[model samples]
Target: MSSPDPAARPGHAPPLRVLILEDSRFDAELLTETLDRTYAAIETTIVQDEQAFVQALAHDRFDVILSDFELPGFSGGQALELARKAVPSVPFIFVSGVIGEDNAVELLKRGATDYVSKGRLARLPLVLERALKEAADRRTLGIAEHRLRDAHAAADRIESRRMALIELSDHIRDMDDPAAMAYMAAQMLGRQLGVDRAGYGVVDTVAETIVIERDWNAPGVHSLAGVMRFRDYGSYIEDLKHGVTVAFADAREDPRTHATAAALEAIRARAVVNMPMTEQGGLVGLLYLNHGEVRPWPSDELEFVRDVGDRLRSAIARREAQIALTAFAASLERQVEARAAELEAAKEQLRQSQKLEAVGQLTGGLAHDFNNLLAAISGSLELMRRRGPLARPGDLERYIGVAQGATQRAAALTHRLLAFSRRQTLEPRHLDLNELIHGMEDLIRRTVGPEITLDVHAAPGLWSAHVDAGQFENSLLNLCINARDAMPGGGRLVIETANLSLDAQAARAADLSPGAYVSICVRDSGVGMSEEVAQRAFDPFFTTKPLGMGTGLGLSMIYGFAKQSGGRVGIRSKVGEGTTVTIELPRSEMPAEAQATQPQGLEPAPRAPAGETVLVVDDEAALRMLIVEVMQELGYATLEAGNGAEALRWLHSGRQIDLLITDVGLPGGMNGRQVADAARTGRPQLKVLFITGYAESVVLGQGSFDRDMHVMTKPFEMHALARRVKDLIDGP
Candidate 1:
């Protein structure tokens, strides 16, 4: 068999060279002829021995190595090992005559590409072709591996630049000062790009200049923090104005940088990059990076610098906006404070106006009421004076009664005013709310008239309340009358009593101590009030009635009574919805006491004890003498004093006194209570009667008194005084 020829081919054909280690000239010739005929072109080299084989391999390149398994000087295994040492990528195949199966397998195992028997020379060509194809595939794979490694290196560079840009962005966001942010951005960009210096410049179009606002330079490098005219770097500025980045490995060689070449050389800058920063379609500034040595700025590095410029621009804008917002907020706060002061002044003026209006209303009401009373008293006194001594006993008594009635009415009016003011003396007692409401059912029905329906709902487990029974009855009656007036067409009135427990939170809102309370609700289906009217419903003389219709003291008196009794009053009303007034009084744990029982039938006034002496102490001489005369007519001996000091002297004089009638308000820094307290040291059993016109001292004392003491308001009847005196002298 002949060896294949190894030669070069035309038209994109790969070159092939064969190394032949065969002793037989016929076999080598046969292989060469077979390859020359089958392939377009190939080259072949024949080496007869081991020495020739080594020499031929050292001097020439080969695609495949074919050898005889056994030769004159060596075996095919030796040739395979030698070929591996010389050219490890070359394919080595064995072709031999009379070779054993085991030997062929052994040859292939020891680095031989394949083995072909000389008897099967036809298979030699196919085996050789496969070996050569395999060798080509290995070369292609090596080339692919080298390219893969290069791509990985490039990817790593890109990732590093991306990481640096991300870190820069994070740093810029937290910088508040625009100038400081620019300096910091320049420093980071210089460090990241390994440049000698970096800076930012603001563009002045009108001035045709570029001002270096901030800059960062490496050690021993000059800073670029100065202004430069656009004319000095005309070509560079022109390129930047068109939004093109100007970069150069050699500033002296770049035509566009010629105008600024002298300045670049002065700074020892060999390479530079200028990236434009634009805002609102206008060039705002430029970011520059300079190198001491010439550098070809890579595409990736340029991209990173551009991103840094973008971040710097955004940070500057944010800082300016923040500064403006802070200034605006400060100005707004000052304006708010000024407006608040003006509103406060206006509110003060409105309060003064309301106060004057209230005073006028009170004065007008007082004048109207007192004038009528005075007229009645004056007319009665004139009639008596004109009829003097000639008047019939009945007529004389009638005239006197007329004057007395007017006086009593005036006194009642004064008492009501005091009550509404919360200055009246109160006699608090523990009483059941259910019982009080039930007892007043008859009076409430009469007051509301037959046309109105009245409902009394008393809770089963009613709690006792501590309050003045008489005052409560009066307040209830007033409410009923007001309800009747409101409902001219006759609606329903509901009075309910319930036990309530007020917690701390609820009690605070009502201005009361947190504890159990008894609630009394009076609901009326009448003409309801609006929010404004309801707010002022408890103001004295603030009446919604027509002139001469109401005194407007009903709700005011009720409010005062509730407060003085350590309770609270609440009113709920809305126009066209009706009204509900609720009174909550502190609950008493003590058992309720029976109300003072009145005699069913009128009994004759008891006469004073015979020879019983009484002391009369008053600040007014006329009042003292009148009291003395009344006692003397009752057939009792009387002693008189004009003041508490004088009364104490009389008591200390060892006078026998059955009762002491003293005015509560006295002069000389001594009150009736102190005098009475002192007189009691001498006569502990003396019965005391206190009289007052306004009862300021008594009200301050909470109206508390012992069983032997009694209080009477001024303008009382002579008959009432006489009856009280007789009762004090009599046994209880």
Candidate 2:
């Protein structure tokens, strides 16, 4: 290693010290001669052996060392290694005549500065020049690297300050609470960034006076709230006057400054930046940033402070708006909740109303069927009694009387059922109650039987009530028969019709619509009903009669009918005292519509003629046999097939069948409808009759029967079945 040659700079002081090791004395002297001629300030030391090389290195400092590859006691590689340990920065070179390119190149890798060949001594001065130049370059690099590391550290500090400013601005912008937002922004600038004191003051721009809103001073600093003024005689006034941010990089000696120097000194604040919060070119407030130590503010950082002031102004205003919106949303939610609750209540009321209406409809339908049956029984009995001698025979009269008593009791129960069902059809007609009762007298007498005495009590000129004549008669007859049933043995049955007006409270107590009405009452002495029986007596099929003798539908049907007709049906009974049923019809305000024209009489059914092939297909063999017998009696050729499959097979066989009578529900893989379908394939013009003990109406769509096809419920009378089939087969 060596210093730059002083002589190379011309008038430089001395020769740099240089060391040379060579196997050949000629090469060593050659290098020394080159240095001596090219550099006026050349100093040279020559070592040719390992011992000399070691001694020379420990004893001297040289500018550079020149070594030969082949030596007496050491190779150039060995000497080079020893030389670098003693002077790590010193330059070394190889001078060798036997050194091929490979060995010369290998020696240079061992930290040799340069290489010279004995045959190339003319280039020795050039090699010496380069070695010295390289030594200076290495030293220069060390100094440059040191300065580069310092520059990087300074750059990181600048970036960190920039990032902190950005984050502080973001924090202030995001604040939603007005007071809290100002306080937090002040704290971040004062505490986190080592400011001595920080505060925000709101100014009434019109009044131009500072109102200290939020402030934070470093530990042991006194409050500065009222001490600062915005109008006059203060440093903040200068900031307000300019409407521009003011920076005091060093607050120690400013002429425009007032007591702030002493105040900052008291708080140990060395510098300050006053950022003005302005909007629309007018100052609104001031955000003061104070530093605890003397530090210069970077331009970017000073700029960021102004941005934060702008954001703070917007944040406070926006927060107030947000609070207003929240209140409005809450009020809207309450209104919606109230409306939803109201709607739910209305829906419940509607459901209850619909339920009542459906119950009324069911009641009306059941009552219609019940009243028809009563009419048939009463009419038949009345005709028979009128033509009979049994009325005079005491024993026969007693039997008749017992039957009549039971019938009256049953009818009474039905009246109550019709009432509950709300189907009591009240016709507002100008009709005398006495006349109506008189018209039903014959039927009532027969229905009550000879054992049960029939009594009619009619109020004179009994008020004409608006009511269905047919339903009224049926209601009366139902009461009579129910009375008769209650008195299994002979008993007295009485019927009465009168006029009455009901009051509102009475109507409500009975759950009836308030109206005026006429009343018909039927009383009988028979086995009466208990409280439990009376309560559910109007429920369909709730009967105490033997299973085969009574269907509980009687009373429920009557109760439903009574209600539907705009009337009230009432019942009274004691377990052993018999019962009385009363029906009240609303008094007539409008006349009832005249009855529609009806067929004068049911046409006598045409008979199934002899030689007519009537197919009877039924799953039940007994039913099939009975049907066959009926068909034969009617002078028809009867063909019987058990089950739908057998029936279908018979029809497919091309049998001459005129009418197909089949039970709806069948076994053996086919139902009556399927059989009929298959039969129609063979006999396109075949007429089919479907019989069902269950609900055939359901299996057949509502009124789905064709004009030529008929449906008959099972357990029908033999004559009725024959007649229905014949009428269907004969009529269009």
Candidate 3:
């Protein structure tokens, strides 16, 4: 096909530079000769591998590209993408025997100019003719559009400064109200700049929020007023906070605003200038000019905006100061009226007797309800006090047991209160839901009792979660018990665990993060809660259970635990239908650990290696003394420190310390985790145990610990602490 169109199409077309990407030598010659038939003069460059093709694209210029759709070590679409990114004005045509119509259509959609199969080499010339002409046409149109934009920008810049200076000279100084001043400034700027929307928003720097109060809008443009976070628009808010004027020609083209391009376009702010107004070196106001269409923003236009924004801010500040003085005078008038109102209030004192009758009625009902708890405690103690003198050992034991049960109930009430308030400590660790449910199933069935049938569904590939295991079990037990009460006559109860994933939209709807999660759903077939009851189910002290039966803090405490663990819980129910309670915990990204099983009971604390010394740090002296004594009893040499400073002192003393056990909360500005990290820098093999009452969420949330470091929540049994320390040091 090569070398013969010289006389056939003589002097009809200009010199066309074509880049061909094909592996077969014969096919490349055939394609080049075919293109030669269409044009009078042509120059062609051929390359096969990606490296040669990329180098050619970088160093050479070409008018058109011809590529094989299916090539060795390359792809037609990949070539098209590279061509579009590098020299987008060039026409990219695919000419290959293996090209399918569907594949050709997809390549066309992705910016390939056209495709021709080798079986139809005669048609390749015509395809090249159309592609080259279209590319030339696009170039012509782009030049015209760019020239128009420049002309418009020039006109806008010339008129911007003179008109803005005229408007800002005096008009704003006459306004008395801040709102009026804000509207006047907006209108003057909007008309002079010919923008879609111009507005003045009061800034609350401490809150990082702005309230527009009002704005001047062009015809058909919607108003944007009310409170909004500065970050909702773009990261340019950071620049504004630093007293910088931010102007961008296009939201999608500017790096500072591109990430929020869709949001800006939605609000008709494709081009914008946000000017900051400062008072005493702190930002307190903003003047914004926005446009629905993308356009160039000149430096002179931005400077004009800054000048007007300052004048508007000064006028508003003066009005606000005058208003504050007026308000002070008005407050004196209010105080005089308050004194007269007090005299009138004295007349109402005689009506107190009448009001007391109604108050007594309400108090009586509350007292009657409170007596239920008081009776249980008082009756148990009264029996103990009266029978103490002549009681046998067995009788005394029974009476004391009764009194202890009453007080235990009271303690449970307080514990639930702390849990709901998120004041109770939690120790979260990586755990698998399937394994956790397998161990807790039997207990769940027993709690629901014989009448109810329990069903457990564990998804085969349930994800691992980070949560407090004991709190999770307690929450599950509470739900199961609540389900049992709902189904007094017995029904089906289902417990399920499954992996969950949420995208941006779904996560926003669920009020959760967009990522992998583990969900536990407890469903029951019984008389269900009404919408009214379900709404208040998580409210503390609001329960459907009769007095003295349920504390109502159960669900609230579960809610608190879910939130504190960076998870969320939701309940769904309808009258006469079943209820489903769902808890979604974020999947742990920490490296997988062996599935943790329920402890079968405590083993003897493993003794440390010979001559191993333990460094104990705590702010509480009594607790520190107790721990040191325990370590000594466990047959380990112990060194003690009352705070983190003293602990670090011992750590840096070149003394031999086999293990470090410190409280998470410590004085002298060094927490237990920080001390461990610092010590490990010098002694990498130092084993650590963090004892804490508060969650120390920020410290542990890092999820950086190795097998040598462990944590134990406060109020843990001394045996548990001893075992943890021994495990870290001895590595069992």
Off by over 4 Å in 3: 1-430, 588-592, 609-611, 701-703
Worst 10 residues of 3 by lDDT: 361-370
Candidate 2 lDDT over 342-374, as tens digits, reads 566556656866877666655664565556555
lDDT winner, 2 or 3: 3
Q: By TM-score, how accurate is candidate 2?
A: 0.29
> In lDDT terms, how accurate is model 2?
0.70
Candidate 1 lDDT for residue 292: 74
TM-score sort, best first: 1, 3, 2
Cα RMSD to native, each candidate? 47.7, 42.9, 32.1
Q: What overall lDDT goes with each candidate model?
A: 0.81, 0.70, 0.81
After superposition, candidate 2 runs with Cα above 4 Å error: 1-440, 449-478, 485-531, 538-610, 650-655, 668-670, 673-685, 699-704, 717-720
Off by over 4 Å in 1: 1-349, 392-397, 599-603, 697-700
| TM-score per candidate, chains pooled | 0.51, 0.29, 0.45
Model 3 clash pairs are none
Q: How much is the lDDT of residue 441 in candidate 1?
A: 92
